[model samples]
Target chain A: MFLETVLLAQRELRRNVLRSSLTVLGIVIGVAAVITLVTIGNGATQQVAEQIGSLGSNMLQLRPGQGFRGPGGASSDSKRFTLEDAQAISNDIPGLAAVAPTANASTQAIYGNENWSTSITGSTNDFLKVRNWDLDSGREFGDGELQSGRAVCIIGATVKKELFGGQEPIGQSIRLKKIAFQVVGVLKSKGQASFGNDQDDFVLIPIRTLHRRIAGNADVGGIMVSVRDADAIDEAKSAIERLMRERRRIAYGGQDDFNVGDMREIMSTVTGTTKILTALLAAVAAVSLVVGGIGIMNIMLVSVTERTREIGIRLAIGALGREVMMQFLVEAVVLSGFGGIVGIALGLGAAAAGSVVLKVPFVLEPGIVVLAFGFSSVVGIVFGFFPARKAARLDPIEALRHE
Target chain B: MNETPVSSNNNGAAANGAAANGALIRLQAVTKVYGTGIAAVEALKGIDLRIGQGEFVAIMGPSGSGKSTCMNILGCLDVPTAGTYFFQGRNVGRLTQDQRALLRREHLGFVFQGFNLLGRTSALENAELPLIYRGLPVKKRRVLAREALASVGLSGWETHTPAELSGGQQQRVAIARAIVTHPKVLLADEPTGNLDSERSREVMELLTALNRDRGITILMVTHEPDMAKYAARQVHFMDGLIDGRSTEGGA
Candidate 1:
């Protein structure tokens, strides 16, 4: 009985194919909007986590600040660390991986006719280990070069491309400001960071060279430390904190003037913000589904009135009220279900294109797809009931008499 | 689903019912009033009527003369306001709405003035509607519908929609639908009202043949004297009451 009624309903809907398609357009757009926003948002969050993961999850950055507030903040007035602090943290801390005392200056890099403005960081080979970078070609600075503060540098992939073009960069000379620095090695590309800054756009020189030749100061800008593993990070951070406090001559219970920021903390904060934005976008998209349901209800009421004579004929032929109700209800469900399928296809396609443009992963969440599809079908039932009941409750005599 | 016992082919009970008063249906002092207070309009006022098995009765009257209301009560589409209606010795007013629907589907069929064949539907599917409501399998419903169409001389028009057929042909398809269920009684309300004289004659011939050949009782409401001439009996109504000049042909 149910199957027969459904077949009849299908034929009835097909009779007015244009109106039926128009009626379901609302559902299609609503579902498509929801699916696309959620998918793109999820992809963005995933890309953020993956990009931050590439920066080494167990690494920590120690800067001279109570808390980060824009650029420099209190760190400009507070005392910066020196080379001894990096050496002390390395020797005193157990289960420590590597530490690099680093400072940076923006300079115009010139190799022959090509010149590009880029930042130059000064540190030891330990900087590569702490920052999780690898050399693509050429060797690191020799110990003698580091001890004598030789004007030698390692160029990143982007810097190498900018200064040397297609030419071999290793053992080549590049001028930074007035000083000539020879490129000892080229680092492999690490792509973009979470915030879209190019990780492979800087040149690395020895710390002493930067302190003497560029800044003319013995103070280090910051310390980059990589813990041995996740389990030892808390212990290593406390140890480094105690040593820095003692060396800096801070009294007991005094508020420390430095902040230790872990990559993990930054990763969670970024992912959390993106997740909230994604949910907000999805919620706004959901409002359209309710509007779509209203469209369904309006169309259904019109349909019941248009088919009044047909309903009369069925009732006169001995169709129970429930059977007539089921017929209209089935038509509503089928229309919305078809809209759901079309919406899913359109949304997934749009999400794929968006991912490429936004440089994020195309994350296809199966649960979300099912949820949107199911919600559309439910919208049909929720909105379709009133019209179906109206159709069923019509008086056969009056309906038949309707002109 | 309400399942009502079908008494269409129950020969023993039907014989007993016929023996009771030589009638298959008995309506005693039936009355129908529409609305209430100053707006109350009595459609059927103290009407008594009886129809024997296998009898073709034509109910004739002017508009607003209660003929349609009488037909509605007989078809179980409605109930009388003040009296009882008996079909095969069972009180029709006592049956619930679903049971009346079951009785309609199982033992009675309906034909309407506008040839209420569904638009965009093939003739065979229109004929198969009641069978579908009865939960008949597709294969069985198809075979039965084919036979009914053949009996109505529409074997080759099975796939034609109503819009594709002439007025006479559409009425024939409606008849095919009515008989596809093997209904013991067929209620037709001005089945030929929308047809030309030629088409009307063809439809009357179809109804007469179904009555004589299938031994099915038929109750038709029409004001056309030409159409009324085809029935075995004619009951005239006026001013919410029967005029008591009913004529009977040889049994």
Candidate 2:
């Protein structure tokens, strides 16, 4: 009996195929929009977390700024950090793992016939430790090279590619600002950063060598601090803040001239914003689903009134009230279930396209797909009951009399 | 059944045997009121009726004379406001709505004046509607539906929609639908009211042949004296009461 009712429902739907399709259109669009938006959002969130994690772990950046870095960075006129500050942080902080003071200068490097313009940063061997960078080959700056101020440098992947092609760069000399620096090491490829900039496009040299020959000054722009463990970060941050305030000569209760920003804090801020945005998009999609359900209810009510005589015939032929109700209910669920399937296909296609266009990963979570489909069927049940009950409760005699 | 299954030329003898046996249906002092209080209008006032197995009885009355209401009660589509109705010696008034529907599905069939065949459905499908409610499997349902349509002289019109068939053909499809379940009783209301004289006579002849050939009990409500004459007996209803009876029906 149930099998026959389902067949009857399918035939009824097929009889007015155009109207049936139109009625389910809302469900299709609603499900599609929700799936597409959520997929792209999840992909973006994942990309953000991965990129942030790649930068460093349990580290903080201390710069010459009153607060977090803005578009132009901190107040430009503020006094810069000296290498002594990096030494002081390492010596004074108990849980410190490494401290690296960096000063940067943009210059053209020449080797053979190829010359590429790139930023040359000066730092100690601890720079790699603080930034979580690994050497692809050769060695970083040794104590002898730093103490003697020798022109020994480590070339990044992009600089090596631009200046040396396939040639080996170790023991090779590259001239920066007329000073010849021997490449003692090569940094591994880190690919592009989240901001679309090449991460491997710079060269690193000993701080003393950079100050004595290339940069001709001992001014450090920033200091990177790495804590020993995640649990030590808060203590390290507070101790460093107190020490820096005292060293920088800031009065009590007055804002300092430098900024100490925790990488985790920045990560949390970005993650929170994206999570809220994703949830908001999902809420909007759910609202549209409800609207879709209302659309189904409206059409079903109209159908009950229109098929009065047909309902009358079924009733007179000994159909019980529940049978009539089941017929209409099954029709509604079948309609929405079909719409959900179509919507899933369309949504995945749209999300794949959007992923390509936005450069985010293509993410398909099975939970959301199942949820969307289940919710659509539930919409049919919730919205279908009223019209089905109305059809079931119709008087056989009066319905037969209906034109 | 008390009557003969094969076609019997001796209709009087068969009806006589039924009169001496248990009745297939019995209505005792049944009354039906449409509304309550001051607006109440009585449709059946303490009316009593009995029909035996294999009997063909025509109920004749003018409009608003409660003949339709009496037919609805006998068809199990409605219940009396006061008094009792029995089908196959079982009290119908004590049954619930779903139970009544079961009784209708298993023991009774109905044919409407409008020919109430579902529109846009094939004749075979319409004839098979009752079997679906009866939960019969597809193979048997199709065979029985084909046989019912053949019995109604619509064997070639199984796939035709009601709108595709003429009025007489549609009525035949309705009849096929009514008898598809081999119901114990067939209640037809104005079976030929929409047909002309020739078509009406043809329908009457078909009903008479079904009664004599299959020994199926038939209760029909009609206003036309010509149509009523086809039945073995006729009962006249006037103002919610049985005013007269004619021919061989009474026990």
Q: Who wins the TM-score comparison?
A: 1
| Docking verdict class for candidate 2 | medium
lDDT of 1 by residue, B1-251 (tens): 12233344343335444343555677778899999999999999988777777899999999999999999999988988888788866689999877888888888989989888888899999999888888889999999999999998999999999999998999999999999999989999999999999999999998999999998999999989999999989999999998978874323
TM-score of 2: 0.79
lDDT of 1 at A314: 82
Top-scoring candidate (DockQ): 1
TM-score of chain A of each: 0.90, 0.78
Interface RMSD, all candidates in order, equals 1.0, 1.1
Task: Give the per-residue lDDT digits (tens) of candidate 2, residues B72-167.
Answer: 899888899998787886778889888988889988888888999988999999999999888899999999999999998998889999999989
TM values, all candidates: 0.90, 0.79
- Candidate 1 lDDT by residue in tens digits, A55-173: 78888788886764432232566789989999999999888788988988888999999998988898999999987889999999899998889999999999988878799998889
- The pairs that clash in candidate 1 are none
Compared to the true structure, candidate 1 yields what TM-score? 0.90
